[model samples]
Target: MTTAIIKPQWSPLTIALMVMGFIIFWPLGLAVLGYILWGEKFGGSPEKAQAYWNKGKAWCSSNAPRHHRNHWNRSSGMSSSGNAAFDDYRAEQLKRLDEERARLDAEIDAFHEYMANLNKAKDREEFDRFMNERRGSRQGYDQNKPDNGDNNNGWGSNNA
Candidate 1:
């Protein structure tokens, strides 16, 4: 029988190292803290756990029926529940649902496109109106400006 070398596993030196690790590097501190808190789960021999897990997985895999395994392996969406009429009806229903989904997706895409076009047209109209207003105001200012000829002081100055 092999005796354990470390007595009183949570030694003061280990706690100090953990605290120092935390002060120096936060991740190291967190790792040390986790090891301190849940240290028991990591120990008690890894070979025993692996052996038990392998046995359980083998039992589960062996117990499953070949038909169920084949059904799972196949990528076909169709599954026969031992009734031909029901299978036919189920397949028809799935096909109809798929068609309806495709039609709905198309309609959604068309609606989005229509909304985008409507927004674009509205923006263009607003921009055109703004440009027209700017041009008209500039023309009005030019027309109201005083003539630069002689005796035209621009504030209605009478030279008489």
Candidate 2:
């Protein structure tokens, strides 16, 4: 007989992390929240989920020492290579470098955007000024020149 089991196996600390993610981005929060709450249930039947969960549970229980090391690595944001202090320092340095890279990327994008907008405005202003000067020159030339449209003798007539 194939029996189905609904086990009471879960953790609430994951929910806290989900909440923190929501504080960062709501969609990311929702995705992780939904996965933790209903991922296996929706993904498959109860028997399948039970089998999957049990398999993981068996594997973890079989590797208690590795599990502890992995847990430490995740919680401390550093790998367990037999040196705690060095691992902590390495994690800190990596985190700082990531933050610095993000900051520099944002600054570069902002600077490029600012320079593009400045050049566009300058070009527009210069074009408008040039058009204004051309219009003024045309109007002045028309106003100062002669308009003897009474004779049809072309420019061959010395009837000045």
Q: Pick by TM-score: which candidate is best?
A: 1
**Could you tell me how far off, in angstroms, the CA of residue 99 lies in candidate 2 after the best superposition?**
1.5
- List lDDT for all candidates, in order: 0.78, 0.77
For model 1, the superposed segments whose C-alpha errors exceed 4 Å read 1-76, 146-160
Per-residue lDDT of 48-128 in model 1, one digit per residue for the tens? 557666888999899999988877864375556888998899888888999999999999999999999999999999999
In TM-score terms, candidate 2 sits at 0.40
Per-prediction TM-score: 0.47, 0.40
Per residue, candidate 2 scores C-alpha lDDT tens digits across 36-144 of 7766554446787787789889988787897786787776774465888888887888889999999999999999999999999999999999999999999999899
Candidate 2 residue-wise lDDT at 86: 83
Candidate 2 RMSD to the correct structure = 16.2
lDDT of 1 at 67: 83
Candidate 2 global CA lDDT score: 0.77
Give the Å error, residue 6, model 1: 22
RMSD of every prediction: 10.3, 16.2
Cα deviation at 46, candidate 2, in Å, is: 68
